[model samples]
Target: MRTLKAGALYFVLVFGAGFVLGSIRVPFLVPRLGARFAELLEMPVMLAVVFMAARYVIRRYALADRRTRLLMGTIALVLLASAELLLAFLMTGASPSAYVASRDPVSGSAFLAMLVLFAVLPALLPSGAVSDNPFKPKSVGGSDSFKR
Candidate 1:
């Protein structure tokens, strides 16, 4: 349930952001910078949103473990990627391979790197400094409830 909640929240944040960013990119950036650079520009925005949203979910839901955070983040990424590809196909009527091949080399590589970082960040960023259990009161020793 917690994973689902976090995943849903992540999806909402990323997808909502993509919608807004896409509006800007398609009209303004794409023409000037081309499709690749426009997408590269959007990468940072998406990463920032993902970082903030994941942290918010972690703190708000008290998701302490790396596993849970990773799971939620992965689920979010899969959904985001799927939606993005689907949108590309529908909007341009381009086959997946054709679309991939069309990406500018530099920007395409950068985007791939960003995707890797997105998968790794959630697990790496969150520290297990807090406990998820509500009944166990936090002690001076921190996450180790028995230490006190």
Candidate 2:
């Protein structure tokens, strides 16, 4: 249940951010930078959002372990990807293969790297580094609330 809740939050935040970036990318950036470059430009912004979202989820949930946090983030990314694909089909009526083939190799590879980073960011930091649990105060002995 905790994982589900955290994953949902991550998914919502990331997807919302993506929608805003996509809006800009499609019209403003794409025309000037072309589809691939526009996507690459959006990558850094989305990656920033992913880090913020991951931290938010970790702090909000007081996630205990790197494993659980990683799992939650991965689940969120999977859901976000699924949602994006669905939206693409609905908006453009493109089949999956066509959609995949439409991607510029460079931008697509960068996007995939970002997705992997999204899943791993939560675990990259030690557990207590991102959490503030009022109920589970840190001990002076250097024991972390997440150690359990």
Candidate 3:
């Protein structure tokens, strides 16, 4: 249940960002730079969103175990892909096969790689240090190791 909630939230966050970015990219960037360049330019921003969204979901949901994180990521990936295909069909009247075939090859390949990254990122990110002050370094051996 927790994993499901986390995964759904993750999907919403990343997909929402993509929707907004795509709105901008399609109208503004595509005309100016062309499809492939516009999509390439958008990739870094989407990557940042994916990283932050994955980290936030994992932490918010207390997804500590590797298996749980992996499951959550998998769920989000499936949802994201479905949503993309549905959106393409609705907006362009393209069948799933047509949509896939119409994608710019270079940008489409990059998008596929991003999808893989999005799926694995939750499990890949570190959970962070167990400290209130995350910047404070831990002593090597003993609590007094830093003292005079």
Candidate 4:
């Protein structure tokens, strides 16, 4: 289903981006970057998930109402955030893991930020926007492609 594929794409976007960023040493600001980059590392994942979810709604589902686009973004963010947190657990004991939850800061910060970001994303998606938008009408002749 389109939704499932979208979700998978979101996961890949988040996981892949995080992994890649995590592996690279910042060219200009290595130490300082390491201290602040976790959230930045998450930006692409968040944007990709939201954009895709919005596209999914517009194309396959009904994004006619603003509520729908927001819903899609919310769902995408939640799924991505869940995947991130799970990764955090898997990473807790690694070498630089102390940099993560050191004295519980990462835990507390991640929890708050993830929830706020995911919860607000949908509501913030721009309305009446399109760019070769996939959310356009799926059927040209007033027909549902999947129905017989």
- Tell me the whole-model lDDT of each prediction, alpha carbons only: 0.78, 0.85, 0.90, 0.52
Query: Higher-lDDT candidate among 2 and 4?
Result: 2
Q: Which regions of candidate 1 fall more than 4 Å away from where they truly are?
A: 128-148
Query: What is the C-alpha lDDT profile of model 1 across 117-139, one tens digit per residue?
Result: 76667688738533465346556
Which residue ranges in model 4 land beyond 4 Å of their true spot? 1-8, 25-34, 37-62, 93-111, 130-148
- lDDT by residue for model 4 over 76-140, one digit each (tens)? 66676666667666766433345344524563475457556554554565554433455454445
Off by over 4 Å in 2: 133-148
Worst 10 residues of 2 by lDDT: 129-138
- lDDT (Cα, tens digit) per residue for candidate 3, span 51-90: 8898778767777787788899999999999999999999
TM-scores for candidates 1 onward, in order = 0.78, 0.85, 0.87, 0.48
Q: Give candidates' CA RMSD values in order.
A: 4.7, 4.9, 3.2, 8.2
Alpha carbon RMSD to native, model 1: 4.7
lDDT of 2 by residue, 1-148 (tens): 9998999899999999999889878989898979988898788889889888887788888887989988898889889889878998999998878888888899988988888888788888666655476446667757474586
- Say what the RMSD of model 4 is: 8.2
TM-score of model 4 relative to the true fold? 0.48
